[model samples]
Target: MTRAEEQRDAGLLDAFAGHLALQRGLSEHTVRAYCGDVLTLLALLPHGPDGNAPADLGALTLATLRRWLAQESGRGLARATLARRVAAVRCFTAWAQRTGRIATDPGGRLLSPGPDATVPQVLTAEEAAAVMDTAREQAAAAGTPAARARATRDWAVLELLYATGVRVAELVGADVGDVNLAERLLRVLGKGDKERMVPFGRPASDAVEQWLAARHHLLPQQTSDPGALFLGARGGRLGARQVRDLVHRSTALAGVRDLAPHGLRHSVATHLLDGGSDLRSVQEVLGHASLSTTQRYTHVSTERLRSAFTQAHPRA
Candidate 1:
């Protein structure tokens, strides 16, 4: 595309990003992914007579959309990636049509493979207990107040993650006021900026209380958000990456398969189902917008059941 065309498309993407964030309430991470996908799609549009690909939103025809997906498929993009890209394009086209940037939404007719059907890996109850135990042990072993405080915080992080199944982002986004220790409840802001109250067990509550007591030792450093429930060693609001690293480190110390924060999320969901919690209640706890999303835990539970029956059944 020409310089002018590139500038125009860039401006369009910026607007689309704003709409995604402000109007659709998409998370910052999701908005970036969608915008990047759309930019890639635009860059790959067929070049026109003047040696510049058409920059007009109207150039996004059904054929063009299909061809873009086909090229991505040829490049061996995974089914989940292609599915996300398709969703991004569809959202763009719908917005374009609504805003009169295009005459029709061609992306409506575009089809791509759905998300992968693979079940997410999760820690068994035993492994989860081990992870928590390891974290607590680490905290107790710390000699210095600073090290002890940080360790305490990590213990709380793992306990809360496994206990409530909040996404790492949601965990980090929470503030001190969001916690109701007396009731063992945490207020979390989840995807699309939706808020919910998730209850945790006594163990998680005790860990958080200990962390709060030691939190000041990690503080008196530069930070604007003092009310943040979690803080880094440098006293800034804790980040999602830090939370993820802690999860991996804790799992490794526990000698279990290393897990991310989302793995803990999967574990909590599966364990809840295994413990006889209803799908709708699990869905509410996880802040899932769709029941089908919550239903995946059922598949995990069923798989576990099948494995047990195959091992112990006499009929086999």
Candidate 2:
């Protein structure tokens, strides 16, 4: 039996996910979703060819696959849930055939989900202002130098996120050298480890100045060394988890419950469109590989329009 024949279905799914991570350079979340889709397939198939022999996933047919999906739907999976699963299987089957694991691709006929009609959540100008105000105020409350330095750091973090619309991972992954304060630009390593230069506005530049000036006061030990742009309490390189917690802490202190860092990112895109920024530029700033992702903000804009109409219109 061939290597594909010898490996169990679960093992193959894991290997495929690894391929996505190592070769395709996909992020952890995308890898997980892909693995999960194959897992759903594995569960539907009968257990193994014995350990030494190749497992017969070769029997996958359009009918069996459709039936499996139908069962999944019957279990009350949402349209989006069903849609992702279909995508997962399609990706796997394509890969499997290309890699010669399967002679026929099962996903050639798989259908995609309908367009996502749900609107994305976005913060209003007032709420965003409130959150920023609270962060600045909290930063001010800490009388110690270290505390004040942290406030500067937090402000920079919030400001950049709000301005650039980059994901939290991209933000924390940024090195000190990647920030070009003079040019008002930030270099980010986004999904797939792709590097891109994104620009921030004056507010973010001011925040960066404060953060950098006080940065030495915060991590005075680093005079010659240049590393991650953000540092944690330990003065070492900051991790993504810490940044996430930092945003969460600021939100909680700001009295905004159920708010996520991405909300601010979303706000940036929405606010830009609301301010007459074009869809293409918003897409570029957000590092979206597809304009379709950025187009979601238009839906957000429409909802805001409807809201304005409801509040302002004097209809009977």
Candidate 3:
């Protein structure tokens, strides 16, 4: 492939990615993953017309895709990674066929091993309480106005995370009007552009109230759109990276295992199931599109129960 052909291939990939983002409603993170998988396959194939880049999607074949997967496996990629690659290729092939770019989908019969069922990390109630307490203490001991604002915001961030089990994107995407203090409810726009209302407890509500009262400290002095629920030091909408950094810092201060926002989400779902919340209810709260996706937490609950029995029974 010549440089021009490579550019065309790259442009096609970008077009497919845009389709996934706008037409398919996939989140940016997911779209990026799909693009990465496709790019890996493109890089593996022989060069195109100019012997510099891979051929176009219309030239793809089942043998070509299988070879790519086999090569990845030979290189020691995980089952999950291989499976995701297969899915990405299949999605792209189907799109190509639909768009008249191909006569048939080469990845129609492609398959890979299923991912291993690994349990996600979950924080116990006591551990979660300690995290919150640490954030609260930080807020109380703030030496400056900015420090106090951050401390308060951190507290609210943790509380809302644990209370609602919302993803980091949803938490940061929230607007000031999305929260209802009196009703203890939050309107969240989750993945796939789906909207759901999740409830929080009194502690989360109180923390948010404190942050709301003093949140202006974190906002820019001459802000135009003042409806963001959370703000950075520069008063812009809080990005996902900042929220992740804050979670890491808070967990470190509490001297507990470091947890990402999704880990906090897992903790809440596991705790809810442990406390007798039905699987469907947990699914609804987590905004999962399928019950099977939510069923993994049951395994966590079962493992915890078996562990308790092993420690207490002592019959062995």
Error of 2 at 233 (Å): 5.5
TM-score of every prediction relative to native: 0.92, 0.82, 0.91
Which lDDT tens digits does candidate 3 get at residues 1-316?
2455446468778989998999999888889999878877776555666765545565588988888888878989878788888888899889989988889888888887787687568789999999999898888899888889888998998899999999998998899999999999999999899999999999999999999988978866677765789887578888899989988888888999998888999999999999999999999999999998898789989988999899999693
By descending lDDT, how would the candidates be arranged?
Answer: 1, 3, 2
Which candidate do you rate higher for TM-score, 1 or 2? Answer: 1
The residue-by-residue lDDT of candidate 1 on 1-316, one tens digit each, is 3566565467788999999999999998899999889987887654466645446565778988888888888998889899999999999999999999999999998986977777678999999999999999999999999999999999999999999999988999899999999999999989989999999999999999999999999887565547899998578899989898888888988999988899999999999999999999999999999998898678888977899999999995
Ranking according to TM-score, highest score first: 1, 3, 2
lDDT of each: 0.89, 0.79, 0.87
Question: What value does the lDDT take at residue 27 in candidate 1?
Answer: 93
RMSD of each: 2.6, 4.4, 2.5
Sliding window of 10 residues with minimal summed lDDT for model 2: 1-10
* Predicted candidate 2 versus true structure: per-residue lDDT over 67-151, tens digit per residue: 8788777888778778888887887888888889888997889776675676546677877777777876776677888989888
Give, for candidate 3, the lowest lDDT window spanning 10 residues: 1-10
Q: Which segments of model 2 are wrong by more than 4 Å?
A: 1-11, 49-55, 71-82, 216-226, 233-236, 306-316
TM-score of 1: 0.92
